[model samples]
Target: MYAIGIDIGGTTIKVGLVDGGKIINSNRKPTASTPEEAVANIVLQIDALFEKYNLTVKDIVGIGIGCPGLISSEEGVVCHISTMKWHNFPIVSLLKKTYNTNIKVSNDANVAALGEAMFGAGEKFNNSIMLTLGTGVGGGIIIDNKIYAGAFSKGAELGHMVIRIGGEPCGCGRRGCLETYASATGLTRMTKSAMEQHPESEMWKFVDGDINKVDGRTSFECAKQGDAAANSVVDDFVMYLSEGIMNLANIFRPEAFIIGGGISAQGKYLTDKLTAYCEKYCYGYKNAPKSEIITATLGNDAGIIGAAALVI
Candidate 1:
């Protein structure tokens, strides 16, 4: 079967075509500020692609879209998009008019998780969680091969799990959320805080004492050098990160844990650290069975791949 997958991110919208779980064509475009315009722009792109391939909408099985907002996948509408300034936008309805194909719309993170479950790390387990530690720690929980969206289409907002009460302010206007201390942004926060406490530490030298200048890579680099400040930052971060994992482990007890997103490029640093801390701190678990916290193998293609799986 052939399908098109679209991921609407804050800055870019990634679109792709998939044939039998493989990406046949893909491209990235700037996200339109208005839902009306975005939908129209997407239609043009889709039509262009079909025209290029000498195919029509009838040739495809479905079109799946993932976006950042409160989406009623069952209703095929986006209820609210805080960043997009959109309310009650019927994205599926708009697309259906053009494609006349099976259309699936859902939260972008959930779609990503779905994709991972179908084709990436989560593929090995019917029940698993995909943790994406990017600018924010986005996540998706897959159980029985379906996304566990909450009643309000707000389920699995795992990034907002309050790992630390009043710890750090989050974009969600909440304090001490898991994303506050576990995401790439959180990593920068940790590095800055560490450098402040140990101005003489190598971390300060690395960033030239410019706290705001620190980033995820700097934290990883300092950690590798065994800098006290960097180690302290990791230690503090692991407290919240492992706690979040422990919470998930205790809840679903999934077969494996898949960590993805940009920060995941740190590889062994994140895996080894997260594993050690999560195992050591988990409650009611004597031995940490192999949960297989593997890095995602599919990378950015999961969105397209998973979107296609909607028809599968």
Candidate 2:
């Protein structure tokens, strides 16, 4: 049966009709000020899809929602969402009251991981982990083809894992969290710092001598061109990221490690390096099964598709 997926973001809500791991139709609507208004808008969007596709209420199996913030997936409650200023919101009950069908909810990151695991990069793997390397690092864990959000629906926060004690400060009020060094923002910081130390580095040419212009690509691109300082930055980034991956690998021993977000666009070069590093340093690397590192394929649609998979 068809399933409806809704991805709630700070500025917009993405709704989609999905079947057999494919998005049949989708729409985006401006976020509403209140949860009630948001649910009404979602229903309208779903109605539009139904009308366009000649589907009926009986045609849909369920609706799944992915929202940002601390979500209690088991309870179908959004415990807190800073972007929407929602707290202890009974999202599942609200949706279920309107539709006599399954209504599932989970943290957006975990939902995206589910989407990737079911239909994207982790399709063939029963166990997988997804790491999103954006402004800040985000992560999700999938075990046995299911999202593992932990007992309180607040687990799988891989980015906050401490790799270094008393190192870089993180927004989570922790020092040396993996995100402080492994995110795209972290990479840019590393690049800018390297350029400052090596005024003659070719990385400056890529960013036009403007440190503000430096991004995750600045170091990797320059390093590919044989820039010494850029190479140092890239190496450092790879090392830090690898450390995080290795830590997760040791704990979960997933069959695949899927990398997503902007930096993942680096593709094979980044995955290859990570795979090599993890294989060499991961505990019991030679004795235990190895997890393959790969890039996520779903892109922006991951959220919608993943959310749908919750009820699929």
Candidate 3:
């Protein structure tokens, strides 16, 4: 049987026809501003998929959705979504009423983790955690091949974990959250700060003195060129990132830590640094088998495949 997976993002909505861990067909559209409009647009895509494939509702098993923000997966309600400005929206109920099919909804990050565990880098392990380093740090945990969302379904807010007691301010109203230092946004901020402090650094030339052009890759690229300033930025980034990874390692001890997001594209350069740092500082490094640090394999399809796995 087949399933429909919908990955709802701040700017786009991805719909896919998935079967046996594969997305046979998919499409994308701009996200609507309102929940009603968003749901309507999704419905249009769902109908289009059915028509394009010449299939009926009976041929499909169910529909799964991965949405941003605080989601109550059991109740299928979105408690809050900062990016979409949605609160207490019963997304599953609305979709079910309109489509008359089984529906499941979950936090986008959690679903992405689930997707990875079921079909991507974590597929070989029964327990794993996925960390997506993007504009913000997103985390999801899998235990015994099942998603562990905690009692309130809000357990895995990994980025919010404080690495520094009083450092840079975070969007979550806290100080020194891991996201403030480990994400792509954090990397850019660090690179910009480094450039400001060292006008003689080559990083300024890479961005042509445009701090706005600095990105997650700037520090890494400059560091590769033997820029001391950029190397310092990368060193600090890896140190704090290792702290967070070690914390999670000691707590969950999952078989692997799957890294995703734009920064993950750095491939072995990123994984090697993370693995080295994790090994050097992770608890019981000498006596225990360390969790492998690896890159996520599914890339963008992880959300869609994972959303579909919710029903499979």
Candidate 4:
């Protein structure tokens, strides 16, 4: 079966012709200022893809879209996306007028999790949780191979769960949320703090003594070179991240936790620590089967492939 997947972003929109888990053809273009213009662009791309592939829309199974912000998948509407200034847009209905096929819409993070569960790192697991550790932590929970977005599409905001009360302020008007300590932004903050305290740390050299230049990679990269300050930052980051993971592990007990986003680029350096920490501290760790911590395989394609899985 074939499906068309569209991943909508603030700057660009990615569209793909997917055959199962693989993207057979793809196109990307800058996002328009309005939803209607974006849809028109998608129509042009879809027509070109069908013609190039010698297939019609009727030959495909469906079209699926992965969009950011609160989405009502059942209603196929985008409730709100602050970055795009969209509110209550009936996207699926708009597309349905032109194509007679199954159509689905979902949160971008949810689709990325679905993509991973269906064909990426969590493909073998019936249940999985995906944590995207980028600027902020974004996550999606999957149970029995379906997204569990929870009531009113507001659940699964895993990044907001408070790991430490009164520790740090979060953008969501909460203190000590997991996003404050476990995200790339958090890692950068920790690195900056460490750099401030340790004037002799090699991390300063990595970024040419400019604290503003420090990023998520600063500490991890410096730690590999045996820098004490950097290693300390990495250890602290892993500790907070593992604490958050175990909290989810005890509650959901999913088959696996698929770790994605920029920090996941550390690969084994990150997962090995997360697994070890969870195994040592998670509830019933010794008495029950454990969830594996693995890196995401799809990378940027996860959103697109996951949207396809919504219909495939």
C-alpha positional error of residue 153 in candidate 2 after TM-score superposition, expressed in Å: 0.7
Clashes of each: 1, 0, 0, 0
Alpha-carbon RMSD, candidate 4: 0.9
Score residue 18 of candidate 3 by CA lDDT: 97
TM-score of each: 0.94, 0.97, 0.97, 0.98
Can you write out model 3's per-residue Cα lDDT over 160-199, one digit (the tens) per residue? Answer: 9999999889999999999999999999999898899999
Pick the lDDT winner: 4
- Model 1, 1-312: lDDT tens digits are 788988788788878888877898987778888888888888888887888899988898889988787888888889988877889989888888777888998887888888888888777789888888888898988889888887867789999999878788888898989998889888887787777777778887787767777888786788789887787887777677778988888898877778888888877778888888766767655565656576777788877787777766
Runs in model 4 with CA error above 4 Å? none
Best prediction by TM-score? 4
Q: Write the per-residue lDDT of candidate 2 for residues 1-312, one digit (tens) a residue.
A: 699999999999999999988999999999999888998999899899999999887898889999988999889999998768888989899877778899999998999999999999999999999999998888999999988988898988889999989989999999999999999989988888888899999988898877888888999998899999988888888999999999898788899999999999999999998988888889988886789999999999999999999999
Question: How high is the CA lDDT of each candidate model?
Answer: 0.82, 0.92, 0.92, 0.94
In angstroms, the error of model 2 at 150 is 1.0
Model 1 residue 138 CA deviation (Å) reads: 1.0
Off by over 4 Å in 3: none
Compared with the true structure, what per-residue lDDT tens digits does model 4 show for residues 205-257? 99998899999999999999999999999999999999999999989999999
Where does the lowest 10-residue lDDT sum fall in candidate 4? Answer: 151-160
